[model samples]
Target chain A: MSVSVAQTALLDKEPQFRHAIPTRDGRTARNRARYTFTVLAFLLPSAIPLLLFVLGPMVAAAWVSLHKWNLLAPMQWVGLGNYAKLLTDPITGDVFVHTIYYIAGYLPLVYFGGLALALALNTALKGRSILRGIYFLPVVTSWIVVALVWRWLLSPTSGIVNTVLAAVGIHGPGWWTDPHWAMPAIIVASSWKDLGFVMVILLAGLQAIPTELYDASKVDGAGWWRRLFSVTLPLLSPSTFFVIVISLINGFQVFDQVYAMTGGGPNGASEVVVQQIYDLTFRYGRAGEASALSWMLFAVVLAVTVIQVRGQRRWVTYG
Target chain B: MAEALLTARTPARRTVGRAPRSREAKLRLAGVIVLHLVIIVGAIAMFFPFLWTIITSITPGASLTTTPALIPKNPSLGAYQRLFVERPFGQVILNSFLLAVITTAVQLVTSSTAAYAFSRLPFRGQNVVFGVYLATMMIPLQVLIVPLFVELKAFGLLDTYLGALLPTFATAFGIFLLRQAINQVPRELDEAATIDGAGHFRIFTGIILPNIRPAIATLVVFAFMGSWNSFLWPLVVLRSPELQTLPIALAGLQGQYTSQWDVIMAGSVVSVLPMLALYVFAQKYVIQGVASSGIK
Candidate 1:
């Protein structure tokens, strides 16, 4: 009986083992096919819209940049003509300079102010959440709302800011209307709206820092300022880098607030690249010029992003 | 934990080293006080504008002389009434809501499916595809507006809701965020389900989706807010008044009623309410979304 049982077990095991290899291989091939299909199926939904709207438009914009075609007119081929015009155009140059000036004035306040807020809120103090919420309110609010409210607030005649300044024996400039103050006004409103975002990001970076580091620094006899400069800032570099890059990108694309508040007014003091693009395309009936300007803006943004990516290694430290 | 440690060490050090310890404690207390004071001032400055907006909106005949009041002397809902009666403001609100909701829903579907593929599925050139997706985030919508407009026109979708909605239907940021969320989910659960003969779809729907609810919630708030607040594209598309979203309609109102600050403020207040309510309710998810995603 034992010998018969052993013989049957051996007979069963031999055929089963021999059949298992090819079936396993077949299963793997089938699984691979299944995975490939699933991946494609999952990707197509996003890929279709993204390709149609984003990637395809990028190429199309490039094509449009090379040709002149108003909505009603026949297409005219103008290879590099628009690009040459963008370089020579005084408006484009002024817009580019203004964009830079705005960035220069805006980014520092956002970064430092944001870091200060984050540092304050990072403490285990009461009502920190409320403070955070207050700071963050403007971030969720629409840019148009912010612009409108600010426009009302900064009105030269009746606005609260000038009124308060008058009470304090200080004269406030005509913010949105004055060429000197228009960009500054936009910058102030933008800083206010964007402050919360930077603060929240920095707060997250701050919280991610382990308690052990602070304790260790304390034990090492580092004062608050020293500890902050050495440990906190170094560790928070990545978030700072992120904020700088994002702010620069958004700064380059400043449109909504400029549109709502100034309409690039006071002789185009606050005219940005996007506002210029809008005028060229719709108002002036120069789609080709607009497309070229758009490409230029894209190139500037891309260059800045690349520079930031490369420059981050100098300052950004990871633990 | 650090706070406790600092307090604990202070008490211990105080017993042995009284003079310096006391000075340090006093300094620390002063620092805390100063910190709180600065934060309070900043908070007030941050909140004062909104407060002013609210006061201005409610105050009847809110003009130059009666401006900057903390409390409205004679508050009225006349401007709000004027907003709806004078213009198709209610319809604009509906349009904004419909667009935001539809955009959010579609973005959820597209982003989640693509995120699942990027995070879980192994396929050829996955890295390259994902890199391309991420690259899209750097390309601002302003760059594509002209061509996108042309493309929509080509498809005869110009001045339509579909045109406004199509460009926003898929976002690289959403996909990146959701993919990061999915990556946090444990792979063992997926493996276990697969061992039970479950397919990728089942695992994605059952395990992955369930685990990433917070991320989804975060994305919802973001996408909703984005769509609700979107100005440029909606401004460019949707030429007709009937199809106009709230922001565009508000811009129109501003143009039409340039000096009617009361009505304009009222429009601003009304447009901000829904989003403010959303933020108040989903504050946690929104903050966490921004924090975890590490995007502004």
Candidate 2:
């Protein structure tokens, strides 16, 4: 019996197959426990950690949203005060507005920048690999560093960007200081750092396209612009859709760049929701409001992602 | 096939007729050159910040962040010295490195197995479980800050290393990536291992681990990079000066008006150097992962 059992195990060693037996038997009961235990092996250390650290914190923030709690004081049951404050509070409104403005400029710059870069490099050219390294450098560089360099570059008087502009007899705005240009400058800086990332995604989409399609188009006497419009654009939608979904999610959570570049400053024209949450929770110890704001962002991101995913099925082409 | 290939691309290669070597050939060459040059220049524009950081870190305080000091007037290790003497900058680096290593190690192990289960093995609520995992990715991490803080307080994990790594240790992205990678791995490999009477754990650890080495490396570098670059989570979790990670410490430093530019640059260099080295080593995989992982 032992030999036969061992041989049977050897015959079908896959875990899923081993557990695919249909029965009301004792062996099946034991297999159930073993399967559950095996599943827990993966969950115990990894998923649970995120569940605790990432997911748990999100849920706690929501719970805190219902209260009037701060770091200094005990939680007070001021149910829904934080959420209510979100609608009526002028400061919250300002932060929300600035967050959208930053997104408005930053997203287009990054998305288009990535797409153009991907297209430019798609041709069979010498040193394409080297071009990739150069393009992707900023995506890996720390935000602290990018922000620092930009801080210098955008410095009004002696900064290189303005210095170059002055050469053309046009003065660049005091980027970090002027309320009008502070957020825009931050967007430009952020876009510079993020362009490579988008390029890589769009590039992957570019590479995934079939060479035969291009040949077929060429056979039919299609030109560069025509080939791009009919073949490349349609085929590249999946990658672009993926990039858009991610960039938008990341757009809502813009913090480090803003923290380093603008400090949400020059009359708070760049104050984002995450920055606001950071101030409320860390600076002011207002955990409730921070959690409330976080929940709001989560909802917005969730809805956006779902809508995008559903919308993607109709438009995005996959091979 | 090999012997025949040695004689290929002979007279038969010319069947397409004389290639257009007129205006079109020259035009194509010119276009490629101009296009590639634009990409190269844009690449420089993006990467200039990293070079600037490295250069500035070694420079002294003179003409830093002022006067078009593109190059230091007199470069010095003066910033490095100031970094250590001025504050607990070394502690911040140590904390970030230590936390990143620990978090990444746990995430890799857990995410791999879970991903294996999702991709290879069927269980109750399998689809639902996977959906739940993907669905959770959209939940703004900031949402759980309040609850996690409270939970940490209950366990006295707040302001501790474990607290910092706990929430990030099991990540959805890790699972998602591992699942995709594992799914691509031939099921025959698993079947062969299992047919040898190996238990599920043994099969995964033995056959799966060895085969998925490249995928694992990809995950490791990414997990390390993300955790290392993580700021907001550590900021919310740890408040003590000695406990803060690199970004948190840098933020604290910059939060105070009149931040010493030299020392901050030094700290920034410290935070970025390890990842830079890792990138230099695994440039291909890291770059690919960064570009693709934008799915958030």
Candidate 3:
């Protein structure tokens, strides 16, 4: 009986195969050539710009990293000199350390804050959409605007934050000015701006989860916390992993806010790698060192991303 | 079926235990109230900075006083009027808008064509090419700024609007996004079009483009926002005050008028308004785009 059934299946598929083969075979060499040409034509426009702006610059940047050349001066080769400076220079080491501190403070706040917001909005609550829009407002606003406004609000003496603190009979720390509080202030502001983005991504993750799992967990006598841990978190790990990688990459390139708000200020207390690169190239006219710094940053980002990609296998679950 | 089971179990459970049900309902009500209260506080915190900026911008003689007023006692548009008159605020806005618009348009064209080839047209080493393209996304614009600037100088395109615009024209993110969208278009449609003697361009322009309008819109929003908020590259390239974009100008204004809180606040408001309007209108596309790209 099984042999007869297999025979019937093959017999049924034979005619369809006969019908499909001729059509595919009918295309001549000229037609194939034309099709190939069409693909090339379609690809060329994007490829040129990508090569010139992105690909070419990448190679050129690598070349520049090995040489000492100001805009006016002729190039002088300095193999590994800039990279050596990255190790020996105290400011570079300090900036790299500050960046790690920033990531330490920033990553958790953004992930947790974003996840908390997403959970709050995920319920069948009234006006949830409006609340979402309110949270998302800062994400769309320009960094310059965000940084400037935050600077005003965190002003050491007369800012609203300090005013509120004084009203509670507590002295507010000098936020952007004080060395101790500067990184924290920046971390808070940066997290606030980015919270909406992470929240939205996680919300998407949350919404994609089927309701049956929650119902099943509830039927199994699981309470809210148990259900969240067992069902939601396991399922949401993919998005969480995404948020971690993106936030980490962005954390390394933390320039705009620092540039606009702190200028790596108060004796380089809030300095980050990108800001250092900016200063090295423009302020100090050390183009080669700056390029090397940029490459170092790129390598760090690449390494982190590779680690995340490899690490996700241990935690992230996809259904 | 599961929902039906839940409903059945809920009703039966409630009927068997009235007192417990009432207590549960009460607890749920209280929990909801607390949740809403927390969300409201968060909302206020999120909106407060913009509110303070607007208030400061409107308040005459707004300054760094011990007590910052939440509401302006005497609001005026004087700061706004002075902003445009005292600085090239209008010119800056124009430059930003022009660059953003041009960049968005060019990226859409380049990204769509490339995305189409990647998604529909199978060729040699397609995966390698795409992998290279995606890898470019990992390289932040900051890494390329120095060399890109030098290259532009070599081409004698430095300080031109074209210089500010060129680096933005082709984005790996845009291509990746558009390719994702194009992949969703069924291959059957392309085959059908090919059977009718329609070429690759015809199908891309007619069928695929129409089907992927949402992706196009998403790319448009991303590209526009990127150019609008772009600071580091534009700062490095455009040295002249006349060629300065909005964010660059705002930073410059803050530097020149460090003590003029009102004027700086006004500049912040002006710089933020266009983006605010865009977000308000295109919130769905923006969120959807971020969500889709973010996850995969």
Candidate 4:
């Protein structure tokens, strides 16, 4: 009797289908077919493009990496020749080293700068919104514009930075013009542009932390420094981990700024992985080698991301 | 329990707050001032380059050999005029605007549909398909430029806007964001619509779209900004000067006008102003989106 009542209720609920309701197995089969068709229909617009452009090209990249073909020439089956060349090339090694150097400098500076901004602005202060806006302005600006502005600002002789430094009775380096200073200059510009993005993410994390925890810590006779170290940093570790991963990924792919500001100049001091790939493909016409180097970069980025994900277990804390 | 906890904590707080109220207020005021001062300095540091760019752009005859005055004695729009009249900048700006708009619109439609499918429609291999989309997000554009360029060439799309727009149409990030939003819309809404004999299209258009307005707005801003500020792909694909986008044009100007700081700065200002305007209007959406997703 209960089963009959439930059946009636279901029939009443789906009134439009009451008269046409088929056998259970037949209905289920028809519904499944309908669902499959609808899913395909909905997915078609994006799937076509993703498959044609993104997914297809990814496979093509791997296939191309194993062969040699310039734009106008016939293809040659290279079967790891490009990989052998890329692995042995001293310039490829230098490019990787430079990319690492950039990450080494950029990761710390951007992370700390962003952290400080996030911490400070997380407080209750008048016009903090405006301050956040100012800090984040560069993140929205195109890298090309930022790079050009920085190149002009660090113009060695007549730039404002050096002018201000000279006012304090200090000499300034040639910045982008100086080989030793080129990567540093790029790092500075990059960090300045990116710190705001980091701050926004970290600020969200900061706001997510429960105030009750702070209250409890205070009730336990903990000082501000102790609370910060034991409570704040530990609780903030997940956001910190995220920021580091993003910064590391971006730092490895540093291109537009390097391309515009220094052009990997001052005798190849700032030649990075992407810039090198671009040069090899477009400039030197070593299409196979360029494809191979890009794959190498892919490997490195993947390895780094995997390691971070695995390493987060030791450091990251969850509430 | 709350009263007990408050009272228990009051004694410790009172000891720490033993100083006179007025004195403590004064100290707090001092702290606020110091905080403001530090932030203002940092703000200035962040804003100075923009300020300097504007100053140089208006200062006629500004050069790299000598610094222009902080406050220009005679500000002029000569450099901006030169950008439009003497160069192909007018067309370039238009191209960037057009491409950004079309890209944003296409992405909104594609991402929303795909998001709906992933959220509501269960198919065989659904998880695997979704996983493929997520994994693709890890492979940066630099990794696929070579093959993409060749593929475009095969289709006779190189150096065209089609080539540039095709690769950016379906972004994994957009789909992820929209799917998250679609999931939050109560399933009952769709079920009710279904009971009312509403088809999937009608339900999607009437229920889901209306419910996820904020997510749509966020996607619009990101897609527009991503297309507008894109440099690398356009740089690789576009060869004709007439087809140049803003970043490529700006880079070209930088290389061509090695010492003409005024004109280069002018281009920089022009390129940045639209972004600044969009940012001001959409600051909340942009900030909230970034905070939530950590997307750059």
Candidate 5:
């Protein structure tokens, strides 16, 4: 798990107080039983649902991935058959590539844009709080609403973006309607929505950097650019790494925006992995194959996350 | 002030340092202005789509092809009326509201109890069980939706609100967040209560819950927003129009009325306003929560 610095700090703190129970006489055994029962009672509310819904479903997914079954049909044992089929399926590869394309475009744009916002707002500027609120509005808005608004904003003929571009004597690309542009359109909305989230995280990181470091650098004749490079970014690397890992994980599951905007249409140029899983099960009645592909995605996500966690030690400076 | 004092002390270097210091102040002022300009521009770009949505929703007879006027000549509330009168939007919104409230309430109870267990109660293999819960956080709901759907059907919960709400009753993120909050409460308070013959239940309610109110508020806002905005499970489970939540309803509206920008944007406004309102009121908690957790 690529735990963020903030989360790890919380988790690593030692328990502050421990119960001191006397081990005299036969009361100790009764007290232990009573303590166990009380603990179980406290945990029961969440434990039942977690077991039935989350953990059980995970095990079931793996089991179903090994069998062939539809919603209304008897299960046919097909051990590893779905995996083999999906491995050869070209759509699976295409969806993975398209998902990668989304991450490739989205990660850099959102990260840098958010970094700029964080840096700008980290100053003691007036109305910075209001500005933060404005930037974060889209983050709270649902993806469906965002996609619809962007679909209108990026409408090929009379949308605001194209209208503005045409005023500048540049013809705008057919954004959601064009095959080559669909993913980019989705990427734009996705990045716009997430910039504030990244900004919030990075801004916290920037605020955590000690002012003494900047003062020390200033005394050393470090200019603005030098201070930014030498002082700000290296210290901001943990939050940066946290943001990237999260964005990459989320980018692979990009579905709602694509589902609303293009429906993976215009020659299926924008079909991503999660949407593929959705379509395979819901639209095509291929539950087993969908489960297989989901497992593949799980593997990819796990591998990527683990690699990032391991790789963070190389670049992520703690302080 | 320090620079001024230093330059004043050395007469020979006074003129040399004073000139650059003035220029440096001017440069700093210019930098601040530039920074504000860039940030303002970015803020406008971020807010423009929302502004456009509101504008298009009000402009009568608006369609996607019509270039939206920043200030409508004669705005009308007919689109909102159409949303309620022509569509079952009233019922849909109510459904979403009810679901969000119920989900938030249930999650708060479940998560707080579980957090109380993890933080205060020592048990065998406690770390291992907690680790398992944390590990589940990394698994996306997409991986479980298929089996979850099948399980719901077996339980005869498909196409019901329970189906949509069941899997969400317990969240690892909520438990983790609340656990952190509970750990911050002074243990002496718990010990004092225990010494006074207070049991775990009373201590949880009287001491822990009251102290962790901020975390509860944060979780409430997030849980409400999450349930309100959740799409995949609701879409898969709730098939009836009468039971549609906001996101599912809006998606259906988009699919059904592909070109009706006014009605669709009106729906967008209705859906977004509650969240923005909640955010406006609790912006600090929301931002701090996201900053700490990096999840939303």
Candidate 6:
């Protein structure tokens, strides 16, 4: 009876009729067979590499996570111990807090600073394209290169930043050495590297707004300040949403900059979760602990994704 | 006569409003100029380090610390010479170059095909399969590092080129993006090919590939950059310094600290120059790819 009701409900929407297999002529059947072979051949080239590297590794990781083992050691039957140990680590907890601080610092510099810069560029002017390219130059360059550049800039006594500050009658702290300043300096550098991308995304959002909306506002005696509040802010929210989502994701995965600039140094003040995990695994040779930490990071990112995906439905407009 | 004087006075007063209007326009112009100046200056603020790296790299080592000139007062190739002469720099560059090329080629071929299959083909459980594929994009490598390392060991592929290349063979974003790219290829073309005697493979290779060169080019540049600059996996798997990629070796330059600035900067310049050149040449494709990804 339940099956009948389910079938009736499905059919009420529109029953999907299954078509019989076509009895094609020799030529058509040959063509179909050829098409099948073509797709299979095309797919094989792409699928094989992924199957070996990504899919296989994923399953293997889960299996390994269940057992306690390290390199040069036999597997111990510690089913949930690896998982439990990650939750209890004091250092991992500290890293998690700093990671949140990093995000807090990262958001304002990029989201707000990027939007403001993008808006400034969207103005009608000569040499705008040239300016855009200069801003975006870092986006294309690898973070490894950017990190190297900032390492020099953030070098405290000999660095240009401090030198310039000294010229202005202000003393600058040793940025890379000062634990309090390390993460912030790293944030400043990451923000610089990231501005080009944020600028572009925001530029796209700005361009998409209809000129008519602005014109209408102007006709109704709205000034630049008034029009921005009424029209631009609402329209720009979707782009803002996209930026925040990815920015949050990036905040979670910020390793290269921290790894390159500070190496989680000045006594682990700049240490992010990923770098902490790297240290445990590669530095300390604690594979299980690192893996456990990784799972913790993964869980955090997962929760954030769930919230953003759900939140997007309410605020993100397709256009 | 009295009314006419009053009208003239009113018209004269209206001209005062016009005077302030011109003044307001001047003020607006001044404000815009100041804003642009600030933005431009800020943009330059971030690039000072890069500028210094390039300048210092050209400077002779003796003057590097003694004089630290912006224009590299006595510019020389001495550091570049040391980078190559004192180390396996050439081999490392070749390793990075070859690894980047092969990885990109493998990724493009594999990703485009899987994308096409997932996009164009009507297979059994297609959505489910593709969902599984998309899910992999978020599985951070750190989580799987231990298992992958163990697996590579079992396969006896540690420190091998294949081991370096294996993990990135399939990128979820590549497939997703390429599928977005290939979906724009009209289904009518495939149907027409079917109408002809051409097999599926012939149609795909001959018809599809020729059309989607831009997307493929975009993928090639992106893949090249990703593999060339990779750090963690290379650091972990490759125990031999000779087998290390440029990034790994360059990162190792960090241990030398203050003494290694010029050499490290030289290495940084070496690691990035090829990519910068490639980007300059194929910038049209790269920019379009970057811009389109914004909308996505």
Better model by lDDT, 2 or 6? Answer: 2
Q: Which ten residues in a row have the lowest lDDT in candidate 4 chain B?
A: B1-10
lDDT by residue for model 2 over B88-192, one digit each (tens)? 777778888898888788887788888878766667787667655755676555555556677888999888888887777677767865664554344656777
Q: What is the TM-score of chain B alone in each candidate?
A: 0.80, 0.77, 0.78, 0.76, 0.78, 0.75
**Model 5 segments more than 4 A misplaced:** A1-45, A151-180, A200-242, A309-319, B1-25, B86-88, B108-131, B134-143, B153-160, B175-219, B236-243, B255-259, B284-296
DockQ of predicted candidate 2: 0.31
Regions of candidate 2 where Cα sits further than 4 Å from its true position: A1-45, A116-134, A169-171, A200-241, A316-319, B1-24, B81-95, B112-143, B158-160, B176-218, B232-245, B248-260, B285-296
> Candidate 5: which pairs clash?
none
Q: Please write out the lDDT profile of model 6 over residues B156-218, one tens digit for every residue.
A: 999888888888777766675566455444455666776897755676687666555545665
Task: Give the B-chain TM-score of model 5.
Answer: 0.78
- Per candidate, native contacts kept equal 0.37, 0.40, 0.37, 0.38, 0.41, 0.32
How would you class the docking of model 4? acceptable
Top-lDDT structure, candidate number: 5
Error of 6 at A50 (Å): 3.4
Worst window of 10 by summed lDDT in candidate 5 chain A: A1-10
The segments of candidate 3 whose C-alpha lies over 4 angstroms from its true place after superposition are: A1-45, A122-125, A142-145, A148-178, A202-242, A311-319, B1-25, B85-88, B109-131, B134-143, B154-156, B175-219, B235-244, B255-258, B284-296
For each candidate, the DockQ is 0.34, 0.31, 0.32, 0.31, 0.30, 0.22
TM-score of each: 0.76, 0.75, 0.76, 0.75, 0.75, 0.71
Chain A of model 4 scored by TM-score: 0.82
Candidate 5 CAPRI-style tier: acceptable
TM-score of 6: 0.71
| List of clashing residue pairs for candidate 4 | none
- 4 or 6, greater by lDDT: 4
For candidate 2, the per-residue lDDT at A33 reads 79
TM-score of chain A of each: 0.83, 0.82, 0.82, 0.82, 0.82, 0.78
The sequence of per-residue lDDT tens digits that candidate 4 reaches over residues B28-115 is 5455567668889999989977787889989887875555578898999999999999998889999999999999999999999999
lDDT of 1 by residue, A1-319 (tens): 2333222322331111122122453477776566567778999999999998898988787888898878578779999999998898788899989888889999998888888777766665567667877888788776766786788789998887999999999999999989999999998998998888777666655644544556666667776676677678876765676578667777887888888789998898888888888788778888788888887887788778777766765766533
